[model samples]
Target: MKILQITPFFFPSIGGIENYVYNLSTNLSNKEHKITILTVNTENVQKEEIISEKVSVYRCSLNFRYHKGLISIEFIKRILSANDYDIYHVHIPFPLGLEIAVVASKIHKIPLVVTHHGEYTKGNVFFSLISSIYSKICRNISLKYVDWILFLTSSYSVSLRLNKKIRKKIKIIKTGVDIQRFSATNDGAILRKKYGFTANDKIVLFVGSLSIYNRYKGVDYLIRALHEIRSVNNSVKLLIVGEGKLVSELKELAKELKLEKEVIFATSVSDEELPYCYAMCDVFALPSISGPESFGIVLLEAMASGKPVIASGLPGVNDVVKDGITGYLVEPKNVKQLSQRILKIIKDVKLGKKFGRNSQRVIIEEYQWANIVEEFEELYNNAMCKNGDGGT
Candidate 1:
């Protein structure tokens, strides 16, 4: 089927939502289904959108508040009107995504499927109120001919707070990665050794776009957990692999806690280097708080890298990591519990390896992009099955 994915940013930009579109669309493209992305016309992206035998990217050069293409409603209309896609699938909650999809559904008489992939319901009061307005608007537009809402986790499914009737339209589909591209390896032997990390020192990695809003990615919790963790084992080192506004502050706190030498803030690491970073880790950590993280993509990557992980026991992360099996899940923002779990993995080498292997097994079974896209393709066919008529 021909699928058109609408989002603000695409490849070259780093984000979970962007990864969802890239990996799923590319996987579908490889399967001989036509896939195209409608995104922002950032200065760096010269082509409006890429078109190939199986995949196409259409970039609209319109600026909005935050690269959301919020300023160019007509541009979105043009993109939607120009394409004769079998299904219009949107991957975000922005005005552009909902607006363009709504218009396209009306003009083209296609079914509209929205994938709510974030924790939109847990933001601050102002955002919560604004999101309420947008959610209502989205629900109204969706209810007209909505076929399905693909939520990344049941937690997010509940977070959307859609009416029970509308909730029936929700389906739980975990975000996926290219498992073939990521596999269990030991980047530590060469990569870590060269990077001044000794085999003796435990390396914990965190990857994501850090912002002021998500400082409690539980990175701070990791730092706080350090006081307890390092009391006995001081060989633990942290590799924070992302850049954001909180970089400078985090650096200072590391110094204040005397962990400056123990923590490495690594941003701008290339894609080729990412797997190695994960492979080098003795264990991986994704300590995101409830609502701060909708789905932990890094957890799967860690599993694929054959590294045991410890994530916050929030809905999305817990849904992925099975405690004492694939990985352990502790309470959100609980530094003590997080520290204790970290100590467990570090202390018991056998249990650590067991968790890592189990993680690999589970991720291979459920988190691979090849398997995940089929679920999406099915949803798309259902969405497009509905014509332009407001017939539900």
Candidate 2:
């Protein structure tokens, strides 16, 4: 099968969607399927990251959106003539590339699959009316052109409420991670020694964009939760990984709470270094405060690292974190619940290990990249068959 993924973001830009697409292509490449990707070219980066013999990357600019005006006529022409890919799998949020895929499906006579990341929720009072209209158009057009709708979480049902038509095409598929990398790195001793994280010091990890606008990834909730966590365990320290607009503000907020030392920030980290951070942590928390955090990829990463997770009970995140077993789930933005859950994991090492092992079990049994790639391959084949394209 020849599969192509289109997204507005990719490597060097960290987030759930970027991780999903990278894992998808890598896993698919390992499956011996011909897989390729087209993403926004940052600094015009072009380097083939060979996941296997079967995968290749083609990077190009929709540079206008990052700097200039609207989508250019050239952008459409560029993608149409890009390459010969059997099926087009597009990850969405950006209305620009999505609109092109809608047209490309018709123009190229290829099967198109659009995965819904989740719908936008907040808007200013004056723009709310325009936002609503834009959302409806996006849903209607996306559903109409897409041969299949890939859902990261069953909770996508809420986003589907506005467009019941897309439900018929929906397939529940989880975003996957490299379980071996995480499980193998959890010796916990070296990382502990390296980071100066003491035995009694409870380690908490928060990874994602720290942007004020993108704070929906929920560093704030994690900060608020710390007030209670520190009360129970003074040695508790948070290691926040990622850089964004909200860094300064979040740092200020931590200082205001007299937690400047308690909450330590890591600007940006390489993937190789992530294992130690994950291995050393007592708990992995993603308090993402957004409607569109379709899935907490890091929860799986934490589980892979043999650590329990504490995450918002949002549909996408809930899909990854099995409440009471794999990790505890708290209501979104509830600082008290978030704090209580953290304390539970910190105080009870048995419970933490139990949940961490359970999380690992879930990853090995269901969320491994190998298993996820198989599902995606089947979806691609079915799409090609429907389009009368050459597919086995």
Candidate 3:
């Protein structure tokens, strides 16, 4: 099938959506399907670049952007007039681009598929409210023309609050991770030794950006929880990976909480070394407080590394980590609950090991990239089969 993936950003950009489009396109390309990514040239990316034998990318410049979304009437006209694609798959939440994609798909009569990557809202209340209203209007119009809509989680679909007309088009397909690189045997000892962590020290890992915009990742709450966790187990150490605007503030927070020694921040790690960061940890925690985190891909990465997870009991997370089985889920931003859950997994070695094993099994069986690609392929086929038949 010839697939055209329309997204706001592409390779070289560090974001969940960017990674998703790259991985999915490359995987499908490798499987003998033609895949082309059309994204904004925000970072001066090549106008045309070959990612693989079957995959290529084309970038267009944006005239203006609000938050992470782009607005370019010329780019839309160019995309709409393009005639090479067999199917049009749009990754949405960017209201402006999305509206254009919808109109283009209808004009071209291309089977349209929409992937909702959570609510792409940002900025303060007044701006956020305006954006929300605009996004909803675009979404409703787009849904009326889309052949199908893919959602990462059921909770995310619920969050959309779409009516029956649009809701029936929803299909839940999770984003996936590479399993081999994230295997349990990926040695973290070298990294642990470099970080001055003793073999006996229990490492709790948190991976993701610390940008002020992403404060909802709940890194602050995790820092607060560390005080309670250390009271019972001083050997426990917190390893925060990634960098952002909030890095200095977070560092100051650790110092103010007197957790300087207990918390070690590794500002950055390369893609190849990220698995080791996960493998080195006894448990992985993500305390996201917002609905934007539709699916915590980091949780799967840690699970693939054979580590137990303790994350916010958000709807999306609950779908990935089974409470008390693969890992424990605590209420979002509840420091006391978060701390207690962390202790539950850390204090008991055997239980922790069991959870880790369960996590690996779950990831391998359900969250591998290979399996996820097949699911997408099936969806593509279904969309094609329905083409010209007025199927939704």
Candidate 4:
């Protein structure tokens, strides 16, 4: 099968959607399907690059940004002219590319599978209204053309509250994690020694971008929560991993809260070292304060690392973190609650280990990449058959 994935960004971008598409495409290619990724060009990356014999990528130069839409007329033209695709799988939240994908699928007579990674829930009231309208327009038109619509979680579909006609096309397919790579065996001693973390200190980890645009991640809240946690448990230390525009601001906030000693910002680390960071931590935290976080993939990674998770009780996040079982879910932006949950996991060694064991078991049984690939294969076959596009 020849598959084309339409997305806004691809490899080297380090975003949730970018990582999702890359992993899915590579896994599909490994399954003997020829895959092509159609994405926007970024700095220091080739316009066209071959990842493997079965996988190739084509990038379109981004022209400009227009009110949440990227204007890439040339890219749209190229998409219309591109040929020989058994299926068109588009990862949405890219308004401009989505419009082109709808037209391309129609003209090419290809089976279209649209995956809604989640809606873009950012900005003030005016911008939110505009985003809502844009998302609705794109979603409705794509649904009209698409044969299947994939969602990461059932809660996400319920949140959308689609009409009967559009709801019929919905399919829930969760994203996967590489279980072997993020195992509990990864040595944390190297990082612990390098960072000078003592056995007396309880490590709390938060891994994600720190950009101002991503301030909804609630790193500030985590910092503040750490401050509150320190008043009682001074041994609690924070290891925040990732780099973004808000790095300085978050540092300033930590300093302002007199938490400079408690919080350690590693800024960035290699993929190989990420697992070690998670394995060393007493607990993992994702305090996302927005709806944009459809499914917290980091929760799976942390779970895969055999570490207990403490995350926001948002719709999508709640779907992943099974409260009191896998880990506890605190109300979003409630610094007091977030602090308490973190303390519950880190302070209780026995309970943390139980959650860690449950985490590993869940990933092995449900969230492995291999299992997710098989699901995609089945979905693709079902879509092709339903659209009368199955077979050679």
Judging by lDDT against the true structure, name the best candidate.
Answer: 4
Clashing pairs in 4: none
- All candidates: TM-score: 0.91, 0.92, 0.95, 0.96
Q: Write the per-residue lDDT of candidate 3 for residues 1-392, one digit (tens) a residue.
A: 88899998786666778888988988888788899888888777567899878998888877887666577766787787867778888987767667777788778777888898877547888778877787667568768778898988887678667879888898999888888788998999999998889999999999997766687789999999998899888989899998888889989999999999889998868888888999899999999998888788888899999999998877677788889899898899899999888888888889999999999999878887788888988888788778763322
lDDT of 2 by residue, 233-312 (tens): 89789989888878998999899999987888878667877777888789999897767676877788888888889988
Candidate 3: RMSD to truth:
2.1
Give the TM-score comparing model 1 with the true structure, all chains together.
Answer: 0.91
- In candidate 1, what are the lDDT values of residues 1-392, reduced to their tens digit? 77778776677667787788887787888778888787766445665556567888877766555322255654566656745767777776656567667777777777777777664434567666766676677654564456677778886567555677777777888777766667885444777765678878988778887766565586888877876788878998888898778788888888998898788888678887788888888778888875747787878888988889998887666788888898788888888898888888888989989998998998888887778877776666666555533221
Roughly what TM-score does model 4 have, to 2 decimal places?
A: 0.96
User: Residue-wise lDDT of candidate 4 within 23-139, one digit each (tens)?
Assistant: 899888888999999888754477999999999999888788643456676688888986688888998888768778878877878788889887775667887787788777756
The lDDT values for all models are 0.75, 0.77, 0.84, 0.85
The residue-level lDDT of candidate 3 at 63 comes to: 84
Instruction: Show the lowest summed lDDT stretch of 10 residues, model 4.
Output: 65-74
Identify the runs in model 4 with alpha carbons over 4 angstroms from their true place: 66-68, 124-126
Best-to-worst ranking by lDDT: 4, 3, 2, 1
Candidate with more favorable, higher TM-score: 3 or 4? 4
Q: Is candidate 1 or candidate 3 better by lDDT?
A: 3
